[model samples]
Every structure is written in C-alpha cells, then in structure tokens.
Target: MLSRGGAVENDRGSFREFVEKQKQKGTLVLLKKPCSLSLELAGVMKALDGKPVYCDKIKEVPGARVAGNVFCTRELICEYFGIRNEELMPKLVHAINNPSKPELVEGKNAPVLEVTEQEVDLSKFPIPFHAPKDGGPYFASAVGIANDKEYGRNCSFHRMMVIGKDRVAVRILPRHLEEFIKRAEGELEVAFVVGAPINVLLAAAISVEIGKDELQIANSLAPLRTVRLESGIEVPADAEYVFEGRITSEMVDEGPFVDLTETYDIVRKQRVMKITKVHHRKNPIFHVLLPGALEHKLLMGMPREPTIFNEVGKVAECKGVNITPGGCSWLHAVVAVRKKKDDDGKNAIEAAFRGHKSLKHVVVVDEDIDIYDPESVEWAIATRVQADKRLVIKHNEKGSSLDPSADPNTYATTKMGVDATKPLVAHGKNFEKAEWKAIKKEEYV
Candidate 1:
C-alpha cells in the first residue's frame, strides 16, 4: 500500500500521512485515541452472536459511526462510486459502454513510502478474525491482483485466505485464474490489497467480457484516480494494505466454513502462496470479512447484477435483483421486471439462469411488486400466477456449490423457475393497463 501523492510543485510523489487520510472525505470510523482491534475483534465476535456494541471512543471521529455491521451496503457502494444507488446500473452500463485507458504514473516513491521488499511481518497491525471457523486472520478483503496470461493486463479480486504468518491460499475458479496460473507454468504473481480506488475492486470482481480491462472501467468511475504498475504490482496510489506474493501449485486445505452464500462448505485443496513483501501506511487498518454477511453477498453476488440486467432486458423491462438471504444468497434470486407480454416472467427466468449459471432457482415478479418484500412477492405469486402456467423450467441444470442438498463433487441437481406476473391479456381482449382509485392527498394526516 505504497501510496504516492504529488505536491503542487513536485513531479516526485510524497508519502501521504496514513490510511485514515486516504479514505473518501470521512469514512475513517476511527477512534484517534488508542484502542486495540483485538478488543474490537472480540466485540465483533459477540455481535455476530447477536450482541453488538462498539467502543464509545469511536463515536468521536466526525462521521465515525459503528463499523461492525455491513460496511458494504448498496448505499455505501454507491457513495464509494460517487453515484446514487438507483443510478448504479446505468453508471455500470455507462462505464461498460464507454471504457477508457487508465492514466499511469511512474516514480521511485509514492504516498506509499517504502515497499518493504524485505523484513516483512504479518503482525504489528490490526487484522480481525471475522468468523469463528476461519483458518486464520484475513489481512485484506475485496482484492487479489493477478496478471492475465492471455494478456499481461491485471485481473483482481480473487480472494486470498491467510493460512499462516508466511502463507496464504489463493482461491480461484478452475477455468479462471487457474487457467492463467497454468499458462504461466504454475508460477503466478499475486498482490493482496485492503483498499483501492473502490471502483477497481468492483470491475475486477467479475470481468464479464474478455479484454475489457477493469482498470479501463475503473478510470471511468472516478476522476483524479490513476492506474499504474509499480514495482511489478498493479496498484492505486492510495491503496491501504498491499502485500506482494507468489501463488504456486502447492495445495492445502482451503475451507470448512460458510461462504458468501452463508452456508458451510467442505474443505478442499487450494493453491498456496508465500509472502515476499508487505507494504502499508503507518498504523494501517487491516480489514476482515465475515464468511457470510451483507458485505460478502454484495461482493460475491452484486457484480452479477449487470449481467442479469442485460440478459433480462432482452426479455422484459427488468429493473434489478436481490438474492434473498433465506436462500443462502446464491441458490435463489428474485428478479424485478415489468411484464411486456404474458410470458415475460418466464422470459426473465431464462435470462437469470444465463446470467448466473449456478443459480438453483429463480422467482420473477412484476414491476409493481416489491422484490425485497417477501409478502409482496408471495402475494403476486398467489394472486397473479397459476402454478401450472407460471412455473417454467424444472430439470437437470447446474446446481450451486453452496446448496448443502446438492452433491458438490458431482454438481448433480435440478434447477427450477417460477414466473409470477399478472396475465397481460386475460379473459378480456385488448385490455388497458390496470389502475387503482386515486387516494386523497395526505389522507393519513
């Protein structure tokens, strides 16, 4: 996390004060007075156990409210991108629509003072243990940078789990970075980061189309942010925690705990890494992610939003999606769409499956319905849908790895979809859209 900032009169970048200063305006919910993250970490443990309370000292840092709950809500995500939550999609579509080249700055030193190429230590910093069953402390969240084998461009956000003080497991999908790692002869360059421009982490989460470098989409999200290759690592000038390492073919047991899907997964062999260098600002904040939390769902599933929106748009006036927590945030998705035809709901079901190949089940609702409201969606299915007509595919489709009922080794299971939308042309022919009686203004008052 060697951040390099330039002064008005100098081409040489100056090392910024600390991680708290690099944050957007005021996101540092820090207690200037000394308090151990160890104490706060214990509090987080209890909070997840249904008892949450933060140190009263933290209440002093301007907008420094409690940071225990999800630090990655939709509102928080939008604020990070400098956009309204409602504008997230169009902004995403816009960025994907108009990609730009990232500005690169090269210098010996940056706000990221020294690289710390040698004499690296994992201790001496604040790293939280987000979950009880985690292998060990996780240093960074929402980041892991790897250069592509097809092209030397960097692809980031493949999570890294701490195995020990000097080791980590680089989690990668078989066909993904695994392919890149293989192409590179099983020797891969990796950098674990705590924070970046925020936009870069979003794009790198899911590189939907090939060759559309996330760095390109990142530059489109915020101004004054530049992308550069430094000391063989791709990074933002103000990144919080950065560690340089190498992912090798050496395998180790990766997990036996809950995932973003919020369900426990069987431990399996995953690639291991040896840390070579550790870089960060003074008194750096080490972020930890709970196995299954709001932040986890957003990081693991939200990136799939644009793909779903794009696919569903072809079939219906699709608005957005919310992966219900009850369904482990991965097995099921509730899509919101405006029915253009009688079968528009069914069309949306097909699109959702295409967007996320692992989706086990999908429920499509009308625009007037609230997808986030369980009762609202149930009402639509109960009143507008006929089980026989609305229910779409129910056959052997790919099953989610998170579904405990499904055999992860074989991935054998069925996928189901329900089309819950009001019939456009019912017993009446050429009917106009339904309208309700207008209510008196301020009637409740």
Candidate 2:
C-alpha cells in the first residue's frame, strides 16, 4: 500500500505523474523502439491488453509518446485511488453525493498551456488506427468538455475520427453534450481532453443528473485543478493535450468501429467538430484507449456500479456489484446482497436493471458468493437457483445496442434476471460450504 503522502502527491490528477509512478513501481512496460501510429502502436497495445505500456518512439511525431492500458483492471484503478477493492463503491457514492468544485488556475499556472500549436494539424499527434475495419484513425480516449447556460459544465467521452488537418467527426449520443449543442443552436465551443487522470476519466463516464458538474465529482474524488481555454471552456490543468474546437452543425459518416461488445458498430452520420486551437505540455504523452478492450470496458462499466449499489440498497443490503467483463461489462452484471427476506434477491435484480438501463441480464447472489469471480457466481447459480421459481424474464425490453443479437434499430431484446441467492431456511441440503483449519504442509514433508 502507498503511503498517505504518496497518495496526496499523485492525487492532483496528472496523467504524466501517474505514468511515472507506474514506471517506478516496475509495472509499466517501456518500449523504446520506434513504432507507427497506423496499426503497430495499437497492435502492441492489444497484445498486452491488460498491462500498462508506454511507447517512447513514434514514427509520425517526434518527441511524442503513447500510453495504453494504464487503467485496464479494477486493481489498477483501486491502486490509483489509494483504496481497496471493497472501498470503491462507497468512495464513488460519496464523491457523487458530495461534489467539490476544482481550483481554477490561470493559463500561466497550467502545465498544459506550456506549449501552444501554431497550426491545428491532428496528424502530427500519435492518434492510432486501431483496426482495419475502423473508418479512420480514432481518438477513443478524449473527453469532450462543454459548458451550457442551463446545465453548467458537462464532460463526456466521444470517439473522434480524424477527417482532415483541422477537423474530426465525433460520435455524440443523445446525452448532455447533444443537449448542450441543441441549446447553442447546433454549434458549441468544446474542448477535447486527452490523457486525463483516472478520477476525471471515471467521473466523465458517470451518468448523473443534469446541472450536476462531473468535474466537481472528479475534484471530490481527488484534488483537481482546472484551466480555461481561450474559448472559455474549462479543462483539467494537468492534462497532456487539450484541443479547443466547436462542434458544428455539419454531419458526416462515423463508424464501422469496434464497440463495447467487441463487435463492429454500424455507420452513422454524426456531427463534425472544427479544431481552432491546440494546447499541450512539453513532450506530451497521448493516451490510446483500445475500443472494446479492458480499459474501455472498465471505464464504461465501473461508474455504473455505484448507481446499481444505490438502487439495490433501497430494497436489500447491497454488498457488492460486478459488471462482469464476460458480458462486455455493459450487458450483464452480478450483484451480491445480504438477503433479509425471501424476495430480496429478486428485488435487487429489478433494481439493478433500473440502475443501468442498458443492462440485458443480471444475477443476484448472496454475500457469501464472490461477485467478481465468474466461477463463484456460476457455483451459486448451480447450487441455489431453480429456473421455474428464481428466474425473472422480461420480453421485448429496451436493451443495449452493443448486444449483436438485439434488434439493431430499436435495441430491443429479452432481459433475464436470475435470483441465485440461497434460501434463508434450507430444506434438506446445507447451503454453507465446509471449512477446515489451516496447517503448514512443509512441517509434515
């Protein structure tokens, strides 16, 4: 475990600082060989999908580096926050419930403003063409930050494809960013932040009420500082790169890219954004998040855990929630609860779906079962579940579009909920597993 002072030093939300710390811990793989931005960079990253990797040499951009899989697992994220696995739920819930505003600093104080680009050419950076089927070189990790008169400030992730020297097509869903664009009459000044801290990235993916600033939640998670761009858009002061732009009314094709399900998403006409200015720290490290990979899944799914915990707590004592990776971390979840009544598991299943609307299947188990372990969850199902009595199925429900089996047009599919909690009163068989005392086998040998 890291000391309190160490956590404080790294809690300011600096991506470069986090990378250096990982390197010092001997967990980061340093690749000194020159690599291409086309496919080689992403290919290497995919090959080492669950490990942190840093590429120091880039063929396209001199003095630029790329880092991937920095936060690919829950253990890495927990370590970054200086917390244990069990504490993550409460920490996120507290941060969301009590948000604090970040300290605003001038451009001179912000390290990201140390260098300003004379011309806006995105190709000069290390943006990777992840796969052959991708429409274009994509920026899968950039967080789009925009301000709204009615909703204050909003931050969300948008996959961007480089279309020209100074333009990119962004896939904007019907979320806060779209609302902000609509309020501004189809054009809004925005900032795309690359290489943000883990706290900021996690907070941006959280689905909170409108008018609630995600940056504030990030600040509550850790000490964070913000700097305003020339367009008056605020971004993390310690970010590696900040692209100031305007999401224009123009629409263009965007997709054939891999999504959360590791499947190709259909092409759609999305909004185009024109970059007006670019700011970065000296020798900035670009963050490349491979689509449908571990890092992507964790970022998209972990934030939803707190929401599920909150909803499940209303009816049962929610112990833990795991958005299992096998479900692509979006469509399936395993929830552990301390059952107080016969229907607690079933109630938790219903509430879990309510917490994450895109969830297609859910399993509710007792506290004894480890929600994070696939085999443990299956064991609970095998021992405690009876399909006729414990299964809850909803037909023709709105599900995730990432599920290829669902109707692509409506995202409609059948949802299943399995109550795999053991009965409070066992009829004949013992629900608890047998235990024994520990001994040192070396003495006997």
Candidate 3:
C-alpha cells in the first residue's frame, strides 16, 4: 500500500479512507431514508445491482449506519488499489506467492477498541437480514480471525446468524477455521471483524495452504495492522466492530439463506459462537453484503482469478481472465491468451480448471477477444470453435456445492472447456473479421 501522490494522497489505509475516497469520486450513493435491515436495504442493493452505497439512517437498528458494494467491480477494485484492472491478477498473484508479515500492535492504540462493551449484545448492531427466507439477521460481511498454537493465524469469512443477544449461529464450512476449531479442546478464541479493508477481505476469501497466514497475503496487498483482542485473538485494527468471541462446542440451527448460486441453502445445525466482548470506534459503520448479489459473487470469485492466471501462465501467455457475472463468478470463467500454438487454448482451459476446482464451464479465446464481453467471447466461440475438436468435457468431477445442477450428495458435476482460439496455420488469416473503414464520430454525426 504505497502512497501514490503525496502526504495527502489516499493510500487506502482503512475502510473509512476507502469510503471517503468513494464519496469524493461521486461513486458512493448516500441513502438517507430510514431503512430496515429486514428487506428494505437488501432490496435497494438488488435494485442498484451492486452499486457502491452508504446508508446514514437505519430505522430498525437505530444509531447504526452501513456501507455495501465495496467489492462490486474490477474497476472499483482498481480504483481502491490505484492500479489498472489488467494489472490486478499479476499483483494478487505476486502477493499470494510472496507474502509480507503483518505488524501486530496494541489494542489501546487501535480505534476499533476506542469503546469496549463488556455486556455483549449482538442486537445493538444493524446486522442486516440480506435474504427474504434467511433465518435471522446475518453478518455476511463478518471476517472471522482465529489462531491455533501449532497452525498459526487464519482469516476467513463466515456467515453468522443472530440467534440470541450474545449468541450467533455460524455456518462454518470445512475449511481452515473449522480445522482450527476442531484442534482446540473446548472452545476456540475468535474475533469477528466487520468493515475491514478491501484487501483484507480479498485475502481472507482466498484459499492458501493450511498453516499459511492469510494476514501475510493481506499485508502484501496492503499494510494490515492488527491488534490483540481481550480473548488474545488478533484482528484488523481499523475494523468497525470487533466482536471478541469463542466458537462454543454448541450446535444450533443455521441457514436456509440464499447462497452464492442465488438459491436457498439447506438448513443445518451449525456451530454457535458466544460473543464475550464488543469493541468499536465512536461511530461505527456496519459493512453489509447482500447474499447471492454482486458483492458476494465478486468476493467469492475474484480471488480465484489470480490463481487461474498463475496456473494458465505456467502453460501459456495468459493475457486476461474474467469470472463471468452470469456464472455467479464461480461456476464459469473466460480466459484470454496470446495463442502461440493451436494447443495453447486447450492447455489454458485445462490449467484454468486446475486453478479453480469449482469452475464448471470455461472458454479460452485469443488475446483479440474481450474476455469481459460475453458477446465477444461468444463471437469467438461461434466462428473459431468446433464442437468435436475444441470441446473438452470432464464428467462427474468435484464441483461447487452451490451448483444446483451438480449432485448435492457428492457435489459432483460435469465440467466443460471450449477452445475458441483460431487455428495457428498459414490459412489462420481467414478467421479474422473483415476490416471496416474508420469513421470520425463528429463527421458521422
């Protein structure tokens, strides 16, 4: 997180700075109307289609404000990082491969611990009910920070449903957090941080090797200053609300909430967390993430882009990679490559599948094709692709659990890869589009 301009230039130090920058850029939409966490706010997010917004008034939960659409688009991410979106993958790849350790500071110096409440009450915060059929108000943007003595620190996102005043039912997937908690004797010390930096959020979402510190990756992306909580767990110093808690050896009903696939996930008995202390700044803003919306999709999908790029780079000169919005940014992808040989496209397609195991469909195209544009990718597939020669299908492969078409029991689905690159030969020029004379816009008008 190097400063770009000068002393006054925005280095995106904290989530507050990021929001302020968005406000100045006229990209942060302020919704002043009294909003409800139940459906009103979620409805607004759906209507905006992941437009960055700031809400000053929450009717249901008084004195609590919120911000959303933080990770809406690649351009928005580019603006935050002060780089072109085209450079994002390379930057993330570098950060993931070569991580920088974070500096641990005292909680006294952190703004998040400015006000600490010993009497923990989850209802005090404006935790939004994102989906219509959700069990209760969920902290979807809450990034959980946990540590094991042997395994070290772990940062990851988990959905926490407000079941009681100090109790939250968390849907703990079988990941690093789950593994950390399992290794513990009784309860695992955890800190659920809200309104952390975008870089921290992205780092938490990525799946690094077990025992690897995701915080280090975050520090590589941007300086991630952490503070020790009362529970001895470390969390982002600039977080809006830091709920020091422990994952109790208790199971509770969670979910039936909308998942990444924009469908209701099955209700299950999940782990319960007992929040012991709540720390916050003077006036905190809750970062809300709409379930199954663009924010959720991007946060879950974009981290994989860099991994895909790195994997494809091993085999081909990968130009760009885009996780299509239409595919929920998880089940599908489009990879652009500077095709040196006829097999470059096919190699990239296979490498992409390896990069992202959940990917169900992939399209590999020439560098001339705009991977971001569905129309352009489709054109390449229509003109350059042959069903028999270009299509590669792998059936019964382990895919995303969110994919409804996949076997729910096994999470197995068929994966397809389409090599849409033109044949590399003397007659390859035949596939090029006919040249049209360039016209001046003013003259044409």
What are the lDDT figures for the candidates, one per model? 0.62, 0.91, 0.87
Provide backbone clash counts, one per model. 7, 0, 0
**Clashing residue pairs in candidate 1, if any?**
2-112, 3-110, 3-111, 3-112, 4-110, 4-111, 15-111
TM-score result, candidate 2: 0.97
lDDT string for model 3 (1-445, tens) is 5463221263536887788778887888899788888889999988887688889789877778899987788877777777887888888898999898878888787888999999987778888888778899888998999989998999999999999999999998888999998899758989989999888999999988898889899989877788887667778888888888889989988988888889988888899999988999888988988888888889999999988998999999999899998999899999999989778988999999999989999999998899888999999999998799999999889988788888988898999999999988846358887889887889767
Instruction: Looking at model 1, report the run of 10 residues with the lowest lDDT sum.
Output: 6-15
Collision pairs in model 2: none
lDDT of 1 by residue, 347-413 (tens): 8999998987777888898777887788988887777776777787666666766777776787777
TM-score of each: 0.81, 0.97, 0.96
Using lDDT, rank the candidates from best to worst: 2, 3, 1
Best by TM-score: 2
lDDT of 2 by residue, 1-445 (tens): 2233345453465888888889989899998778898889888888899999999788888878889999998888888777888988799999999999999999899999999996999888999998889899999999999999878999999999999999999999888999999999999999999999988999999999988999999988877899988788899999999999899999999988888888888899999999988999998999999998899999999999999999999999999999989999898999999999999999999999999999999999999998988999999999899899999999999978678999989989999999999998898888887798899999999
Error of 2 at 206 (Å): 0.4
- lDDT, candidate 2, equals 0.91
Candidate maximizing lDDT: 2
